[model samples]
Structures are given as structure tokens and as C-alpha cells.
Target: MVSVLTKIFGLTNIEIAEDIVHDVLLKALESWKLKGVPENPSAWLMAAAKNKTLDFLRHKKQEEKYARQITPLLQSEYTIGHTLNNYFSENEIKDDQLRMMFVCCHDSINEESQIALILKTLCGFSVSEIAKAFLTNDSTINKRLYRAKEKLRELEIKFEIPVPSEIEKRIDQVLKALYLLFNEGYSSTEGESFIREELAAEALRLCLILSQHTAGNIPKTLALLALMYFHGARFNARIDDEGNILLLKEQNRKLWDNEMIQEGIILLNMASTGDLVSTYHIEAAIAYEHCIAKSYNDTNWKNLLNYYQVLITLTKSPVAELNSAIVISEIDGPDAALNVIFKIELADELKNYYLLPATKGDLYFRKSDMIKAKYFYDIAETLTSSPFEKKLLRKKSNMCT
Candidate 1:
């Protein structure tokens, strides 16, 4: 809706388009209450929006620049040959939508504002949720959004789908935002849950859209898609029937989506044809190795460690170091893992990050240091946000005690 409206009326009228869409939503909410809900609610909403836009344009012919764009588009778009169904075809709308996304993520906007606009406009994120994701105040986020849209209006940038030459450069920004969103969803830094599948689901959907486009099969793109699918395939098994957290080893692998895994593997193979390697490329490779292991015990720990090394080399993060500690415990022993952990005393970043303590607990537990393990587990329980993760930590704490 935003895509079509923005294309027709221009970015200056985005607020007007939003108002029309919001009005239709209000009507739907009211109508659904009385008329018992329409069979094709989306189609009904689109029709209402089209009518409203036409009406609005009719009244303000002289005042609107979109008055000119709407005539030809409306004629061609609304004709019997074209139809609403053709307008809304997944590929057609999506192609325009992604071009809009690239324009939204333009370098002119600061990274914070770019992300905010993309979330609110493209991804349908609420202001409050996006504010929460960044651990910032709502007013601050709102200001950024306001400033961003104002810039777009002032610049008069046409929403466009880029040509083949520009797709890779533009898509990098889009992919970055998607990754950040997926990470927030995958393992929320602020949320109580270890993972919020909703955020991950949206990211996966956007990435799938990216994958299906002409640029989709690019090696890096395929690798990222493969990585997301592999991780997504495990969502169901990661939690128990009651939604309690389940450790990877304890998870029922049978519940993992075999189709997604196979697809991921195929994409990974495709990605290997290219020489350029990104942090995501390395991380995805590591994830692929884990997915290939038939069981936890059957995992090629040595090869897994090698991938981790590659990941750390490409992107040396504290979290990567902590992750390597776990692999060391698996391959060599707790003594080896403890040496790795003790060498790094990261400051306040891990204060609220549950995985830090959770990893510590695992190493201590393996070393027969029950006292230290219990303390770490207790800390992990406090650090964790998800109901599932907290419960899992408490379970570990009880066993440790």
C-alpha cells in the first residue's frame, strides 16, 4: 500500500497515504465487529484504499503533484486488463517494495534513522517495539523517524528499483538491516527470551524476497539466506511443547525442518563458488557444520572449531570468543575452556547478556566446580529475559545446587 501510494503521490504525501491506510484499518476494525469479517479482508482493504485515494485526489486536483501521476497509473492500473490482482501480484509489488527499501536506506540518512524508517515503513514495526529494540526512549526514536521522512520529502527522491549495476551496493544496506533485525529476533539483547521468532520470521521473509529477486542468488545473498533458514529450521525444536527452553543437545532434532536444512545446504554449496567472504559467510559456514551433525555427539567438533576460528578471524567479537570457549570444552576439556575464558574479562557489555554466564556455567559444570557452576547459573537466570530462558536457567541452577 505504501509502495503504490508513495509511487503515485510521491514521498511528500506519505503521511497522507498512511492516513488513508489507517482510516481503512479503522473501518475494518469497526466493520469486522458488525459484519462478521470479510472473506478476503486484504482485497477489501485494498479496494477501500484505492477508492479513498481516488476521492482524495479528486478533491485536491490543483494542489497535488500526484494529480498528474495518478491519472495514467490509475488508468493503466485499474483497467479491466490490469486488475487489482495483477497490481498486487507478489513479484510486481515486491519488486517495487524492495526498490523503495533501497531508497529508504539511502546513505543521506544516519544509520539510526535509516533503521527506524525501514522498520516502521517497510517492516511494519511499531514505534514502541522499535524503541524497545534499541533500548532507547520513544521520543528519541520518533524524532529520528520524523527527521528522516522530512529529508526524503525535501530531497524529492523518487522511489525506484535500482538497475543491475546498483543492486549489490544498495542491497548491502538492506541486508545489514535485515541481519540486525534477525539478530534481535534470534537472541534479543534486551528481551527475556533467548529468541523472538517473530523478528526472525520478518527478517527471513524479507531475505526470501531478496533471494527471489535477480540479485537473490548472488553468493553472499545465498549464504545469508542459507544461514537464516538453517537457524529458522530449528525454531520449533528449540522450545519444549510448553514453550520452555530446550538446549540444543536436548532438542528433538526430528522436529527440525528437513526441507529448510536441505535448502540451506544447497545454498551454502552455491555460496562457496565465490571468493569474497563476509562475517555472515563465516558465521553461516559455522552454523552449517552444526546443522550437518546427525547428533550432538556425532558433531565434528574439530571442524566446528576450525570454522569458529575463521569466524573470529573475520570478525573478532567478544561473543565469538565466548562461543569458542564452549567448543573448546566440547573438544579438549573444561581446563582448556577455562584458560580461554579467564584470559578475557570483558567489562559491562555482558552484565545483562545471559549467554555470557550461561557459557561460564557450562565450563564450570564440566570441570567439577559445582560451587562456581551454581553461582554462574544463578547469574544467568537473572541476566536472561525470556520466560523460557529464565526457567531453563533456574532448572540448571537447581541441579547445580
Candidate 2:
């Protein structure tokens, strides 16, 4: 809704569009509470939004500024309804959303700001939710959003898909933001719940939309979508009835979504058609290894380690190195994994990352070094804000006693 309205209002008047959306939603809440939800709730909302937009445009036709390209059409009565009807059409709304994705990921904005804008405008993430996702405060998120909007306005960023020549580069930026969004949902940093299924689902939905478009139907896009499906397929078995985190070794393979796994496999095969081997391809391969295994012990750790090594080389991410160390432990020994962890520790790249200490604790526990394991578990507990993680770390610490 915001995207469609932004197309009509222009980037400079984004707040106006936002206000209109909020009002429409508030009105829905009130009406629904009194009269019950309409049979076609989605159509109802879209109709309400269209009516509100028309009312706003008609009232401010002569005074308020709108998109320069369509200003004259909006001002004239005969063209106003037709123009709006065209924008509100199903195909145009989808196009507006895709355009909004590109606009949020404009090269002029920094990556962080791009992501913040995407979360707020495109994904319907609240300021507080975005703050929690970023492990920051609402004030900081607000500032990032403010600056991002100002940049969009100053540059007069068009709400249109990039041309063919620039589409790949622009799509890369959007993919990066979506990747982070999915990760946050898959292993959320917020509250007690480790998974925010809705956020991850939203990311996947947007990725699917991108995949349907000619400009975004590239190998990298398909690879990322495949990765998401592989990960999402495990959601049911990732936690216990008590809402505690379940390690892969403890999860029930029977609970996994086989249908989703099949979809991921299909997408992965499609992704492999092109010569470009993105980091997502490697990551998805690693995930696919785990999905195909009958049990944790049956996993092909060597294959996963190879994929992780490739992933680490491509991205040089400390997180990937840490994950690769875990795979090494499965193939080699705890001591081997510890050696890699020690090297990562020396670099101090993951100094404040709770997972670093958490991984160390797990390694020491496997070695039966209770004292060191407990020590690392204690540090890991202190570093993480998630109550679930803290509880799990404490559980490990108690085992040491």
C-alpha cells in the first residue's frame, strides 16, 4: 500500500503516504471491531486505501505537490480517477512494490540505511522491531530512517525499476538486504523467541516476487531463494514444545517439511544452470547436505566443510569461519575445532559475539573439560541478550558442575 501510494505522492512526500496508510489501517481496526472483518479483507483494505488516496488528492489537487510526472493528471478530474485506477490495478501494484524495493536499495544510500528503509517501508517492520533486529535502539533506527528518506528526497529517486544495464547491480543490493532480513528472522535476536517466522516469510515472499520478474530472475536470486527454502524447511524441528532451542543433533528429522525440501532442491538445480557460483549457492549446498542426511550422524560433514570453506573464501565472513570450525569438529576432533576457534579468537573479530564463546563452550564440553566449558558458557551467557540463549548457556554451565 505504501509503495503504491509513494508512486503517486513521490519520494519527497513519503510521510504523507505513510500517514494515509496508518489512518486507513486504524479505520479498518475500528470498523472491523464493530462490524466484523469483511469477507474479502484484502480487497476491503485496498478499496479503503484507494478511496482515501482519492480523497487526499482531490482535496490537495491544487496546493500539495505530487509526483511531477503525473501532477497534471492528478489535478484534472477526468484523468485523476483513471490514473489512480491504473495504479491500483493488480499488475501496477506489484510493479510499484518491485520499484519500491529498488528505491529502498538505491546506491546512494549506505547498506545499513538501505536495510532500515526496506524493513520500515517495504516489510512493514515497526521502529522497535527493526531496532531489535539490528541490536540497536529505536532512536538510532529513527535517525537512520530519517537520513535515508532525506537522501531519497534530495536525489529525487524515481520509483521505477532500474534499466537492464543497471538492474543486476541494483538487484544485488536488494538481495543483500533481503538476506540479512531472512537471517534475522531465522535466528532472531529479539525477545525470548529465537525465530520470527513472519519476518523470514516476508523476506521469502519478496524474493519470490523478485524471482518472477525478468530483471531479478538471475542465478544469484534463485540461489538465495533456495537457501531460504532449505533453512525454512527445518523450522518445525528447530525448537521444542517448551520453546527451548533444539540443537540439530536433538531435532526430529521426521518433523522436517519434506515438501519444502523438495522445492529447495528444485530451485537449487535451477540455480546451478548458470556459470556464476555465488556465496548463496555454496551456503545452500551446505544446507542441502544437512537436509538430505537421515540423521545428524549421517550428515556429510566433509561436504559441508568444503562448502563452508568456499563460502568463507567468497565472503571472508567471520561467522562462516566459525561455522566451518563446527563442521571440522564433526570430521576431525574437538581439539581441531578448538585450534581454529583460537585463531579466530586471536583476531578479536568476534570479541562481542556470543556465538564465539558459545561455540567454544560446546567444543570444551565435548572434550570433557568441564572447567573451561563452564567458563566459556558463563561468558557466552553474559554476551547474549536473548533469554533463550541465556537459558541454554546456563543449562550447559550447569552440566559442567
The number of the candidate with the highest lDDT is 2
Clashing pairs in 1: 192-385, 192-386, 193-386
**Candidate 1 TM-score versus the reference:** 0.85
What does the lDDT come to for candidate 2? 0.88
Candidate 1 residue-wise lDDT, 1-401, digit = tens? 66666765667777776777778778889989999889998778777876776667656655546666554545443462354345555666787677667777787787779877877776666677778777778899899999999889788777886678877787788778778777777765354343256678877887877777776557787788888988888877877778676788998888989899999888888878867987778778878877888998988889878888888787667678778888998989988987887776464555577888888888888777889999999988887666677878888878875
TM-score of each: 0.85, 0.94
Which candidate has the top score in TM-score?
A: 2
lDDT of each: 0.76, 0.88
lDDT of 2 by residue, 1-401 (tens): 88998988888889988898889989999999999999999789889999999999888866734545346887788898888889899988888889999999898998889878887887767788877777789999999999999999899888899999989788998999889878878977464243278778888988998988888889899999999999999986888887888999999999999999999999999999868899989988988999999999999998898899889889888888999999999999999998988777755678799999999999999999999999999999999888888888999999997
Q: Which parts of model 1 are misplaced by more than 4 Å?
A: 31-41, 65-90, 110-113, 128-141, 154-157, 163-166, 189-195, 347-352, 385-387
Worst 10 residues of 1 by lDDT: 75-84
- Evaluate model 1: give its lDDT: 0.76
Model 2 CA deviation exceeding 4 Å by range:
67-69, 132-137, 192-195
Clashes of each: 3, 0
